[model samples]
Target: MTTTTPPTHLPPPYAPTDSDSDPDSTFRHIITSMLNSHHHKFGFLIYRVNYDNDALWQNYLNIIDQQTREYVVLEKKEHLLPHIAWTPMEDREKFEGATKDEIREFFRDWIHERSEDRDGPGAGVDNTELIRWSPRYKACMYVNGEMMQGAKMQTVDFLPGGPQLHVQGKGVVVDGQYDEHDRDVLRRSAVGAREDFEEVEGRRGWDVGWMYFTLRGVHMVYETLCMSEEEWTSP
Candidate 1:
């Protein structure tokens, strides 16, 4: 099918803190440029974990999976994901490595597939076999605010070039340790529209900015929303 170019002109790339030789920086700009807006801007990244170079794991089934259990997860550091006992999935194997282009094409096809109708394929898409959590890669989504009690969430103030250091916030130590290098790599594209708490107090405009990160080594993402907040919040 022939597709016409979108009449809407996307904004120029958002700046990154480490653009000189960072693929993540470039990828962040490319994806965020798609969701440009005058009133509000948003960027979401679904990436494999990096920086935590030595955390071990063994279980990946959804029930025992942190992806499912994390919400009910308590503040106990031992109960946190890395220290949990390892178990295997019954029906499917672990998630495999998905490259930047393969994931990009998946979205492209999904877009064209849905453009014909808004109901969105009318059935569940099977990504369970495709993506799984592994020891090497820890899949993480870019959540705008504080997640865990001590997650080193990157803070991007809407400045001209982005923050020199990731906005420093105190986070918890899991299993008696905290990996200060917390950045999510773009295994897939970006997502969502939750209103991030602005750096300016009581002056919340829409969350508009970009964040750069890198890929992890293990398996992750049996099912992910990329945390689609706009769909959840749209009135």
Candidate 2:
């Protein structure tokens, strides 16, 4: 996918001045820009494990597979279908039955091997990391701050000059800075809305500004609200 260079002189991060103004517009702008600019074949796979309940896990997998099937057709993209990859925890063990710890170890090692293959010497310049984990599961592919543990979660390897967002379950959360290399790439496109808003509202009283406007903090709040609305109405 293509990326626009962030503006050279981006102001400090945005902060909200009032309750009514939404800050998530910034995130939407960034996400939309990334999607439009980058034309790569991007997709995601989610694997779910229930510590003790095999039936629940299987039900969840079937539900997700069915949903994915619908989404593939709707997107008119075949690649999006088999985009989901699932393996049950129970099946990971043989008849001798490896312990959960052993299975986890195997899973990690398997993932690392795949990552190495995608990024190794003969693998060209391409780099990739698989398996991002979060404490909670939310809707598929609509990740945001409210559904995650924020700072405590493991970070994913962000692609340079590509779409970068946190993935947990089926959702994508947009928070944190992209990797430093990608940050540099995005630096040129960075718009300084925070400073601009502060300048415009500098003359107003603190209470008035605070009551009437919101800074960058509003971005998460707005995103949460929007996602909530979408989930509530979605079939």
Candidate 3:
């Protein structure tokens, strides 16, 4: 490879726009772009799991098995009447091998279906219930650590208004009119994580982490890295 000397003249600097100075606009654009891009890539929400145990290995195996199996199949034959035909009960499919676009459509349809299940067995179910039905979809980690008897450290917790004491991992507090829709979405995402953990790992002696949103959804996990308030009403 050839190396060249730099010229004395420099290029013009980037000029800041009105949106660049406005936190709301900047955050909105950045978050919207990220969400849409992720949605487009995975077609569904995909969590980033961090682990250092054998359980995670088992979870991976389960997911792989699901993806390679039949997309949907009937559980058992059911006949309503003596001359009636058997009805098929469709089972939900896994996310393995699914294109990003296909997953997006799947999530949209899943939300729509749950929202309209007003009078069925799924009545009163939240829109995010289906997505949280499996433990693999949750963002979480399994690790080992130790605390000394005289050790003292700063504590952190996530609340409805935002993270208490600190915003995400940044030691700064963001005081603003946080969107209500976004707050509710974040809250529900947190609830789903707890529900999944309780149902799946509670009996196995697993304990809740110190962090409130320890097992949050993938989007919430991303929120820790960026301070964007994109409305999730459309999501």
Candidate 4:
């Protein structure tokens, strides 16, 4: 065996900032910085099934299993995600194995489609009726936690699926104004959100956790199966 002696000099230690000193804040800082963009900034509106007792969770997921219903993609935009929920029904039914990007695109396009539905051919259709056909957990995403301002359009209790709220479990918002076109997008989105959750919405359950972290397809049936088993467990 061979051994060597080290040089007499040593390197400097890392100087920590107040933010870095707080481990929780440091983790949060990393996530927020990564999410501060349009493309990489993500959405996270999801049901959190947090419960200790196994039996209660089982009861809850029995309801979740029944929650899958189907809807058509009227604008030819539907793929893995649509409107507020990530599970878009393929042919008014579901298929397995969609990519995360496909679902994110679904969310992005749905935002765009809301504008089209307003002035485009979809105007002939009653927009409110469209919303009435969605799931109990209506959701949306904005740049930060702040909502875009506009003419008052009705909203159901839609949860936000933006990136910041779930990980370290807190978020901060910087508010801004929305012009007419922007406002139209925001308002119409609310109506669609209401339709999804209005009838089915229940007071978010007690045993449920805050959110289900997944690889892709925020609410897609195929993707959700991969969630922590407790999420779909019912008593």
Give Cα-based local distance difference scores for all models.
0.23, 0.27, 0.26, 0.24
lDDT by residue (1-235, candidate 4, tens digit) is 1101111111122222344324333123222221221111112222211223434323332222222211112212222121222211221121123232233343334443442223232212334422222211122211111111111122234456322112111211101111225433444565643233222123222211122222112234322222222122211
Count of residue pairs whose backbone atoms collide, per candidate: 19, 29, 4, 19
lDDT of 2: 0.27
Best by lDDT: 2
**Taking the tens digit of each residue's C-alpha lDDT, what string does model 3 give over 61-107?**
23322321211111111110111111111112433333323333433
TM-score of each: 0.19, 0.27, 0.20, 0.19
Which 10 residues in a row give candidate 1 its minimum summed lDDT? Answer: 171-180
RMSD of each: 21.3, 19.5, 24.7, 25.0
Poorest stretch of ten by lDDT in candidate 2: 129-138
- TM-score for candidate 2, residues paired by index: 0.27
Select the stronger candidate by lDDT from 2 and 4. 2
Residue 113 local lDDT, model 2: 45
Q: In model 3, where do residues sit more than 4 Å from their true spots?
A: 1-94, 115-235
180 in model 4: Cα distance from truth in Å?
A: 30
TM-score rank order: 2, 3, 1, 4
Q: What's the ranking of the predictions by lDDT, best on top? A: 2, 3, 4, 1
3 or 4: which has the higher TM-score? Answer: 3
